[model samples]
Target: MVAAALAICLRQRGLNVGVMKPVETGVGERGSTLSDAEYLRAAGGAVDPVDAIGPYRLAAPLAPLAAARQAGTVIEMDRILTAYERLAAGHTLMVVEGIGGGLVPIGHHFNVRDLIARLGLPTVVVGRATLGGVNHALLTVEALRQRRIAILGIVLNHTAIPSGPSGKGPDAIATRQGDSTVELVKELSGVPVLGPLRHEPMLAQAWEAGLGKVAAEDAIRTLADLIMQDVP
Candidate 1:
């Protein structure tokens, strides 16, 4: 959803942007399902072919390696790289979304970290803005740094509503923990905390509306501007 939101924000700025998912698992039922790549393409107004947007589409809804194994296919890194090059040649900027986390295995002996290193693109790590988010964000940042990936920044995405069933906002515990998570992730990772995005329920509404509703908010615009500043 963050990827889609970012794509929308970039498009609103009149940039020729393209979105790619590289590898997608958990494809929904045929003829009625839109994958992440599809949503991104629509959101970014991308003209690239579907194959270029997502090189590998797996059905098992697992890690790429496991999903490919279940389907009796192997993920070839060169294939993905070739597709990326082809897609990159056509766009001024490309927003490539990775599957799962940094350590996720895309193929035998190759992980998301390896893919990022190979692509040689600056990355913006996205994590949930909830309890325990600090640990997850910091750990992912550490792993990326260890692999020498250029991290542009971090985006703490608020994916859930702060209010609970009782019609009250987040409890004291959650609020305190979330605040600490944002501060600590920046301090520990030594990367700019690009900005915090408020939960945009419009995303789901847009999806349900068949991508007709392009959700744009202040947070999305802010993050988009930060990304543009980071882009060389």
Candidate 2:
């Protein structure tokens, strides 16, 4: 969700947002629940075909390289770029969600960082808002920098509720962890940091509807404004 919510926020701002996952693993066949790409496309209000939204759907719940190999396929950066071009053709902006992390291998030698460099689009790194967020977020920023990829900012998303010892109130440990993660990442990231967005349990059950609930939050709106600043 941070990605899906960002897409919705962009759409709400009147940007014709095109979303892509490019590669998705752990997909169930013909399920009631939508895949990540589907949820993103729906949230972004993109009319692009699902094929364009996600060119590779792997069955195994593994990293891209391993999943593609298990599926007897190789993820071609060119293929993904082609699909991206198709989606970007009509939309004013595109939101391409990265799988795993920047160092994740997609093919024999190419990684997500390579793909991002090839796409030539600025990125927004998303990391967990719980403990260890600082390490993950900083590693990603440095990894992308190694490829000279433009990073717009960082977003620390709250994927789980950090319950305190009492495990009662919403603000228990969640507030402290969120605040610490956000501040640490911001101070050290060398880029803007947004969110640690409130945990929305409904997101897991209802992707689109759950995102609709927080699409207008201060962080999402601030991130959208930051993105729009680069819109020439």
Candidate 3:
């Protein structure tokens, strides 16, 4: 979803963009069955082929190491780096969404942070702007810093906020005034907040009406603009 959103956002700005999911699992059709590469192809107007975009396709929905272990396959770190290079070649910017959280294991000997460090890309954390979000986002930042990864910024994704009382909806409303994501982010410090994302009506409506493609491009473009604002 992040990849698709980013693609739509960047495409709107008329920039060529690519996405890399070094390890993917539990994909089916109806978009759910789709591989990360396929999602990029559908959401990213000018996407590379699936094989060229994503080189590792695991079979389960668990951690890559666990999944690979179950399948009796090895998750190669060098292969991931090579795949990333293949997807990144000739592109001004590439959005690489790691599987699971920042600490999730990718191979027997490495995790997401290792990938980030090896890639040497400025890191941005995409998080839910909800109750526990501050904790999760902060911990993520701290962990990355501990690993010596350059922390870029935090993008609190409002789209993933829970709606009920269990969620941060009440808090977000009280603070954000039901307007922008910026208000919800003033609660944190350290990293630059970048901006908040309002749920795009066109996107929801398109998905609900079974016409996601109608607004997919526009949404991708909008997100791309937001991402560009923070690029150094």
Candidate 4:
């Protein structure tokens, strides 16, 4: 969902965006079901074939190295990097969403964080905005920092919003959520909060069109603005 949303957001800004599942595993005879290459192509209306999106489509749906091992194939790092560089060439920004958590295995000895550290791209760790999320968010942030990856920001994906009446209407609700996120950002490494993504149909459309919803637009733009502010 965050990948979809980011694709939409970037597309709306008129930036060329490519979606890659990169190291996919667990296919029967077809292919990886969670593949985002097609979705991104369709969303971006790009003529580039999905193959150009750099999918390592594996057949076991396990960790890349494990799946490759199970299938008697090698997980080639050079190949993966080549694919990523190919798509990243013409775009100002490419949002590469990982398969699982920050620690998912990528190879014989490396994990997902290792992949991000190698790529050296600014990364936004997506986390659920629910109970226990703080710990998960902070720990993941720490791990990524330890790996030396530049932390772009934290994106709190709200799976479900509490149902209630707010006297402040949408603006109020947004303000309250924004304040909470700002507090979290200040407390955690001073990384900006990219805002919460509420599950909604408009969000799907905005994502497809690459347009940021009101909240996402403000938050993403603010992060961009502030992150640039820190640039010397």
Q: Pull out the clashing pairs in model 2.
A: none
All candidates' TM-scores?
Answer: 0.89, 0.92, 0.75, 0.73
Off by over 4 Å in 3: 29-32, 159-187, 199-232
Q: Candidate 2: worst 10 consecutive residues by lDDT? A: 162-171
Candidate 1 displacement at residue 221 in angstroms: 2.8
In model 1, the Cα lDDT at residue 132 comes to: 79
For model 3 the TM-score comes to: 0.75
Ranking by lDDT: 2, 1, 3, 4
Alpha-carbon shift of residue 172 in model 4 (angstroms): 18
Give lDDT per model, in order: 0.80, 0.85, 0.67, 0.65
- Candidate 3: worst-modelled 10 consecutive residues by lDDT: 207-216
Better of 1 and 4 by lDDT: 1
Residue 21 lDDT (model 3): 75
* RMSD of every prediction: 2.6, 1.9, 5.0, 5.2
The parts of candidate 4 lying over 4 Å away from their true place are 26-34, 161-186, 201-217, 220-232
Please report how far candidate 3 places residue 109 from its true position, in Å. Answer: 0.8
Can you write out model 4's per-residue Cα lDDT over 9-119, one digit (the tens) per residue?
A: 566656676666567665554444335566656655555567766456676867777887888877666777787888777665666768777888877777778777777
Q: Rank the candidates by TM-score, best first.
A: 2, 1, 3, 4
